[model samples]
Target chain A: MTSAEATAHYFKKAARIMDVGERIETLLAAPLREVKVQVSIELDNGEIRTFDGYRVQHDNSRGPMKGGLRYHPEVDSDEVLSLASLMTWKTAVVNLPFGGAKGGIRVDPIGLSSKELERLTRKFVDQIQDIIGPTRDIPAPDVNTNPQVMAWIMDQYSKYHGHSPAVVTGKPIDLYGSRGREAATGRGLLYIAREIARDVGLPVKGTRFAVQGFGNVGSHAARLVHEDGGIIVAVSDVNGGVKNPKGLDVPALFDHARKTGSVKGFGGGVPCGSEELLTCDCDVLIPAALGSVLTRSVAAEVRAKIILEGANAPCTPEADEVFEKKGVLVVPDILANAGGVTVSYFEWVQNLQHVTWDEDRVNTELEKLMREAYERVANISRTRKLPLRTSAYVLAIGRVGKATVLRGI
Target chain B: MLDQLMKLPMCKGLSQGEATELASIARESQAKKGTVLFAQGAHGDSILVVLEGQIEVSMSGQTLAQVGEGSVLGEMSLLGEGGKRTATATVLSDARLLEIDAARFQELLKTSHLAALKVVANLAQVMSKRLLAMNEKLIEGNKGKKEELADFQKILSNWSF
Candidate 1:
């Protein structure tokens, strides 16, 4: 299923568990706003290129909408809507005082020149600048976007409404961004793993970890786990994976990735296929790469006791079913990778307050929130005997429902 | 004992012979409370596995952490250069420790013993984690000062094009 369908599938499951009527479900499920704009930018070579940009504000009962703005060839209303609604639920899950919004321009950013990219970003901001603000809708980095992109969004929006830095998030740290935002998602994943280890009687220091996708989330999680004395035996990026059963040399692997731009040829470990890496025996299997990877077949082959989702929608309903049957604890993506958004919220707050926070402070605050959220979800899971994924959605949906009711919506 | 060794992350799922070879290098010591296992800056190279009781590890007169059974210490300096102890470890209670000789570990690793290699990997990781934490400290800054906090709304609302 596409991300949208998969998201709806999970939502329906939780809605059933909560037994909320169809009217409330439909009310919570619908978007608060949908924006589509024609973004026309002049290329460096004087060619005028037009891109379709969309923003989906899924909910705002609790607060303003918040999500990422990705630049990709496949950006569409459906995908943006699904991700937007996820942000609504995600913000609620983390107890952040924000709702959900996602915006994207349907363009392959890789093909754009720096000048063209800047023009496109500025133009997109001009179109939606009126709708987004510190207490309205906030956009952060996602997919093909980065901190530099956020910097452009902030600058462009500032032109329209003064130096309103809170209009966007994920900006460069020098440009009013939170310090720990870069490593927040991965750090959050590590924190969740630590909590899980504490409960499962598995000490993180010596446990075996196999991480899929060595991006920001995966690499940081691996480094932290390694530092915590967890043995990382297999790590993969888009190129492929490298493995060492004894334990991969994580520092060397990191250097290799830094130098070579991928983890596949890090000589410290033997070449391992992505399939092999996914199915490898490990105490913790973190899917931080692409979504829909853990299909029925892949999920059946998985040898992990716990799968910490570090990417968006990494598991399908079929895969989720297999894991549920086999008793593998799959921490949902909303809870597992909410660190990025959590820090985005922090960055926005810092921008609004005109006060910056250090990395350590940002991380400590993140830990407290993540741990508290984990406890809330775990308590529900334990008391209701519900799977973690369902429990998380139940918590999120319930919170959103309550907020909607209190707001008389 | 082999089963317990197998349970530890360092010696996880080792072959019987590999576990035996790893165990052979250990000099098990029993000490009373207040026993100093190793002192800071001293030439201590063996890895200490806390098999019984508790130990307090400290640096610069400040206690960093207290480790109980199944905790590994001194593995950092054992795998690190200079082989000098970086922290002081004192037994908090009557304790038993398996002090694995670095020379024997080196020999076993040279022979490519699986269990020895596992320990080395885990030790490197343990030290690398500590190094990362230190690196974070090196770059971490204090909180934003109250004096520096700007009146964001006032400043923005007063601005004109």
Candidate 2:
């Protein structure tokens, strides 16, 4: 399922445990705003490539709209909607004073040159600038998007808003990006995993973990876990994966992956398929790559006790059902992967105020919030006797619901 | 009094006298424990510094550290070109504080470039040291975990935790 379908599916599941009155259902069914714009950019080849872009401000009942702009070949309204919805819950899940939104273009960012990418980003921002503001909707980095992309978006947005740095988060630090943001997502993943492990009575040392994907999130997660004394037995990337029964050297693997862009030829372990990387025996299995990696089939064969989702929508509803039956504990993406946004929130606050914080403050603050959120979700799971994913949704929805009610909306 | 107050590192480099002058530029307020001084991520015109007692640095409700007795809590957001309060600083005890507007802080920096430079340089050094320590801590903390895990794995080579 796409991020949108996964979002709707999770909402439906969470709503089952909620009051879900007519008013609540109405609020949850569709986004608060869905913006579609035509982004026309001239390619280096002198041909114009027009791409449809979307910025779905899912909800802003809590505060401003916060999310990322994805650039992928599989981008679509449904997927964007799902991600937007997820952003809403993810922000709420972490208790950030914001709502959720997500945007994307259909074209592949990798196919675009630096100039083409800048032109496309600027055009998209120009079309959507009216709807986004520091207090309205804030965008950040996502798949195939980074600080540079954010800087472009900020610059484009500024052309209309008079150099408003608060208009965007995740810009280059020179442009108001927060320190420690590059590692926030991975750090958040490590934090969530640590909390879950503690609750499940798994010692951090010698705990085996398998990570699928060696990109920013995956590599950081692997390195952190390895640093935390967890034996990272397997790790993968787009090319393939590597596994060692004795535990892969996360730093070495990170170095190799950085040098090679893939973990296949790391010379430390035998190569394995990305699919097999998920089913490998380990205490924790983190899917940090693309979505749908943990479909129904893979979920059935998976043996890890915990499934911490780093990638959005890595698990489909069918896969979720299988995992539910297999008694696998799944930390839903919104809660499990909210560290990035929490830090992004910090970065934005820093930017708008022209302040910078030490990384310790960032990571410490992140750990405190993520752990507390995890504890709350885990408690809800136990109290409601619901799965973790469902519990997370219920917790988030309930928080947002309370806010909506308190605001008399 | 204003000139002397400006000499403090946390003052953002107003001469003690300039800080006093700048302090007069905004509303002065006193807060007690449980008083919400300012919240994380808030952008406004004012910056607060502890004049007496203590302020607790918090984010998402957890107290990370404390600021007390002439320490600056909100200047990070005031002196920088683009800044906002990254963490909420709550009054940990009944205390006196000087709240200065962003404009006044900038004005003071402009009026006394020497004082401003000194203040900026001091904050820069403090932030740099803090950041370096945090980075090393992050790496070392992880290394500690890894070492413990390796030892555990060695022990568990024949058993389990």
Candidate 3:
């Protein structure tokens, strides 16, 4: 199934479990707004290029829409819709006062000069400025976008609306961005992993982990886990994979990856295939890369006792079924990777109040929220005898469903 | 005033004698709220360090950064070959500032090599820290550029575009 179809499949399952009526399911499943804009920019070579950009505002029953703006070639309406809907569920799962929205531009940002990139960002903001704002829809960094991009958006937006920092989150710290926002996702994953380990009676001190896709999420999760006494056995990036059963030195690996731009040539571990690293022997397996890596066959071969999803939709429905049969506890992305958005919410609050929070405060508040959400999901899972994924979906669906009904939708 | 200058990051390692001597050459200044310390593109011969309250650095009426106590402003102009202010600095609040004339400071540096070396070293450290911070922001900004480019390339390989 397509990514949008897959998201629908999960939503349908939760709707069935909750016995939510067809009207509510249809209302919740449909996006509130899907905007497609044509972004044309003049390249540095004096050539003009046009690209398709999209913003899918899924739901706003909870609060103003909040999500990221990704820059990629395949950022079509369907993918934006899927991710936007996921954001809706994600926010609800963590009980944040926000709905879901996602947008993306179909361009390879790396190919653009800094000036061109700035112009493109400003133009995109100009197109969607009417639909998005601090109280309307707040955009954060996602995929290929970061603080500087957000800074550009904030700057461009402020030109029209008088110094409004709340229009976007994930801006530079000097631009009123929150501390600890960058590492929020990885830190949130660590919190979830700790909770899961305790529930499964797995001691973190000796637990082995193999992470696929050593980007921000993977690297931070690995480093945090290693600091917490967990043995990170394998880590792979787009370049290649590295493995050491005794635990790869994370700090050294970080330095190597930074220098070489990949973890492939690190001296601390043996080289391994990226695909093989997924099903490698380990206590916890984290797919921190792209989505749909763990299909039926790969899930069947997976030896990890637990799969902590660090990336969005890393497992297809078929793969989830296989993992269910194998008794491999899978923490769904909605909960496992909700940290980024959760902290994005914090950043939004700080901007709205014109107050900045210290890193320690941001982290402490994030831990509290992640832990609380985990406990709620875990309690429901045990009581209902459902998978953690389903329990999370149910909890989120129930919350959203109640809000939808109460809001007289 | 010397004690306050010693507390600033830019004056961290200066000896008491050195700080006192530097303080003698420095002039204490105050600007009320809404006062512009220096306009963008203007020639700047002094570096102002914030002693109390906040100063906003802006360009074309857009506020870029706010430097508070212990933060130095106009260093770029002092260090730049053109010696022209890149951004306008305005007092955000009634503020106390220590203004060090670039020429006077240079004269002090010429007279006392040890003090000069220490000040130069401290300035280098400050510039390095700023450069490192900017580098980090750029890296963070461009974190997924390569991976996303690869994603775009894969799409192109599959499609005729």
TM-score of each: 0.71, 0.70, 0.71
Q: What residue pairs are clashing in model 1?
A: A205-A229, A227-B129
Off by over 4 Å in 1: B1-161
| DockQ (CA atoms), all models | 0.00, 0.01, 0.00
lDDT of each: 0.86, 0.82, 0.87
| RMSD (Å) per prediction | 31.7, 25.4, 28.4
lDDT preference between candidates 2 and 3, better one: 3
Error of 1 at A183 (Å): 0.4
Which sequence of candidate numbers ranks them by TM-score, best first? 1, 3, 2
- Model 3: which docking level applies? incorrect
Residue-wise C-alpha lDDT for candidate 2, range A315-400, written one tens digit per residue: 99999999888888999898888999999999888877778898999999999999989988888788768898887887777777
lDDT of 1 by residue, B19-50 (tens): 88788888788989999998998997678888
What CAPRI-style quality would you assign to candidate 2?
incorrect
lDDT (10s digit) by residue, model 2, range B1-161 = 35325645655545555454554665657898889877887774566666687888988888899888667666565655436677888777898876667776577678775555565677787778889999999999999756643443342232110
Q: On residues A1-409, what C-alpha lDDT tens digit does candidate 1 reach at each position?
A: 8867998899999877766656567877999889999999889888888999999999999898899999999999999999999998899989999999999999999899888889899999989999998889999999999989999998888888888889888898888888989889999999999998998899899899999999989999999999999999999999999999899999999899999999988898799887788899888999999999999999999999999999999899999999999999998988999898999989888877889888888999999989988887888788879999888888888778767755654
Cand. 3 TM to true fold? 0.71
- Which ranges in model 2 have alpha carbons more than 4 Å from their true place? A1-3, B1-161
